[model samples]
Target: MNWYVVYTKPKWEKKVAEKLSEIGIVCYCPLITQIKQWSDRKKKVEVPLFNSYVFVQLSETDRNLVFQVAGVIRYLFWLGKAAIVRNEEIITIKKCLSDKSVSDISIVSYKKGDKIKLESGIFSSQNAVIQEVTNTHYILVLESLGCILKMKYKKDV
Candidate 1:
């Protein structure tokens, strides 16, 4: 079976993936661990790499089965066709996310107005645009949400 992309409710990728798996559907929900800091303490948490999206391997006949799962909204479509993700692409994503060198890969030089995929921290994997830079931090604008964030730069990233 080929892989197809599924859109899910907000913050439901993991739950949808688990439910699909329980019913014998093979699903992939890539997750990344990042540190979340609060006023009192800090902790590392696992979050979905692609928010609100999951990958499932199934044939056309199984589409309805997937739709039956809670939190699964619909298949991602392009030009009225369900989007098919190539196996190699999935493998590459898995490799990039699972590698021990992920931290090294996260470090990047960004410029003003450049769109960046947040690699770690509480906003891990969120897309934002650089608005300003300082010697010690970056000012990012979350364009979609109309919010601004200041992130401190760390050597290890």
Candidate 2:
């Protein structure tokens, strides 16, 4: 058996893992808990470490069985063969999941000249000139109109 990357349908990482597990295939969907605030309140939620992918351990002899799982896009591959992911990468991800210090990971201050992409919301598809970014918010000068707008984007943005 080897570790393989499974490309999942958009936002279907958990679902795919479930289906695979029910069929006795071992899978891993690493996640980190995040505290998010909406207009009215704050809540903690678990989110996938990788947005659209999950890892699985499967036998090279049973490669065809993997494709039968719902929501599995395909096994990540190169050069016309299944690609095996190194075990060390998975070990590191597992460490991060188990580490209490993960929540204490520092947020570096954003510099004026840094390039950024919008990760979500109305302007999710555009890039902006970052005027300033902080632990919880960012001030960007939207490129299209040259207007400055302040947004409270998630840390990963």
Candidate 3:
């Protein structure tokens, strides 16, 4: 069985995973602990690692079974087809979560003056030169469009 990504309603990731588990569907909802603050006090809470996403392992024919549970909107699609998550990728996510000491495994190492291609968005398939790198975002110069773009990404990566 291959792993597929399921899109859940906002803030319903954990609930959808739980319901899927109750029905014998193997689902994974990675969570992390965070300190949340309100006007009065701050408390620790477990939040879904990836917002609105849950991973499930099942056959292609059984993919429809996930829709039987509430809060499941649909499968995430890539290139007009349901996206498939590789087995090794799942294991790696679990491993990194378990081992905090592991260094950041960013797929692309961005330094100043490196030319890279924007894979998605209107700038997609266009090459951009790295202008600056910051703690949480990158400043790229897309000369073809005569505009500079700033992209923000997760701090963990």
Candidate 4:
């Protein structure tokens, strides 16, 4: 069987994975733990590493089984064919996420005026421009929206 990617509804990655697994379909929905702080409390939560996406291992004969699962939008396609992910790539992601030290490593290289898409957090998938870079954060200017946001570099993008 080959691994194929499926897109899920918003916040449905975990649910879809669970449902698929219950039906005997092998599915993987990678998650990351993050500490969230509020005015009076802090808590750790697990969030999907890739928003709205899940991986499934199956053959072409079983492809319809995945589509039958609720919340699964569709399979990701490349050049009109389903995209295949190598087992090694999935293993690497699992290993990296398992290592706490490497979890927060951000390796993006951005310069002023470069356009980028936010890959995580509340403003995820929003487009912005790099206004400035400091020692620990990026100053982003959302020109069309007339807003400026400060964010730390993250590897998710």
Candidate 5:
């Protein structure tokens, strides 16, 4: 069996892997614990190493089995063929699972109109207004409160 990268629905990597496993497709979804601060309390949550994607350990030769797993949009391939991930990256991700201090907090780029929700901190539940997009953070204005705050997000978050 070989590991093939699968592109799944947004926020569905973990679920997809679980479903695939139940149907006899082995998967490896590396995860790390992230501390999220929401107003009064801070809680640690497990998150995937890569968002919207995960690796499945299956036989690429078995095309029928590959296509049967639910939530699996497609396998990532190189030059029209399935591309397997190197063993080292998997090892690195496994190692990161134990690192409590490690986190992904970089903000993604924003367009003229994009929907976003605060992932953490004081404005955790408040939706942000995209005022300006920057390389490091998004300049968001809370229209109702008339306060502008910059939320930092990681590229991997």
Candidate 6:
């Protein structure tokens, strides 16, 4: 069985995953704890790590099984074919979500030549070596990709 990505209705990731699981479909819906604030108080809530997305493991013949559940839009497609999620990538997500160190990441100060493993965003699960750091952004070298990435950072005022 191969893991595949599924697109879900907005705010329905968890629900879809649960429904799939109930029907004997193996699915993963990564979640993260976030602090949400209200005028009266603040609360910690678990939200889908990837909004409107869930990963399902099933045979190609059983791909349509997910449709039996509600809130599943469709299987994610890439290059005109269903997108396949590598097993290693799914393992990485599980590890990151359970790892505590990432929850305490503080990039307030940077050290040149420091290597970091990204846990989210486009570079998720990729390792990058910090080449240069500035108040606005960091220049990172992704040896695996054999390229340098320069992206902006937003800091609270």
Model 3 has an lDDT value of: 0.90
Model 2, 34-53: lDDT tens digits are 78899999999777877777
Superposed Cα deviation of residue 7, candidate 6 (Å): 0.2
* lDDT accuracy of residue 115 in candidate 4: 96
4 or 6: which has the higher lDDT?
Answer: 6
Residue-pair clashes per candidate, as listed?
Answer: 0, 0, 0, 0, 5, 0
Q: Highest lDDT among the candidates is held by which one?
A: 3
TM-score of each: 0.67, 0.63, 0.67, 0.67, 0.57, 0.67
Candidate 4 collision pairs = none
In model 6, pairs of residues that clash are: none
1-157 per-residue lDDT for model 4 (tens digits): 9999999999999999999999999989988877889999999888888888999999988898987889999999977999899999999988988886775633346889999998888888889999998767899997777999988764452
Q: Which of candidates 3 and 5 reaches a greater lDDT?
A: 3
What are the per-residue Cα lDDT tens digits for candidate 6 across 1-157? 9999999999999989889989999999999888889999999988888878999999999998899999999888878999999999999889988998788322245579998997788999999999998977989999999999996788641
Per-residue lDDT, model 1, residue 106, is 33
Pairs with backbone N, CA or C atoms under 3 Å apart (clashes), candidate 5: 105-153, 105-154, 106-153, 106-154, 107-153
**Worst lDDT window (10 residues) for model 6?**
102-111
| Candidate 4 Cα misplacement greater than 4 A, ranges | 105-157
lDDT of 5 by residue, 70-145 (tens): 6778878777987787777777767766566765633244774576787778888878678887777778888767
lDDT of 1 by residue, 43-130 (tens): 9888888878999999888788997898989899967999999999999989998789667323246789899888888888889999
Report how far off residue 101 is in candidate 5 (Å): 7.8
The stretch of ten residues in a row with the least summed lDDT in candidate 3 is 100-109
RMSD per candidate (Å) reads 10.8, 10.0, 8.8, 9.6, 9.0, 10.8
Model 1, residue 67: distance off in Å is 1.6
What C-alpha lDDT values do all the predictions have?
0.88, 0.80, 0.90, 0.88, 0.74, 0.88
Query: In model 4, where is the ten-residue run with the lowest total lDDT?
Result: 100-109
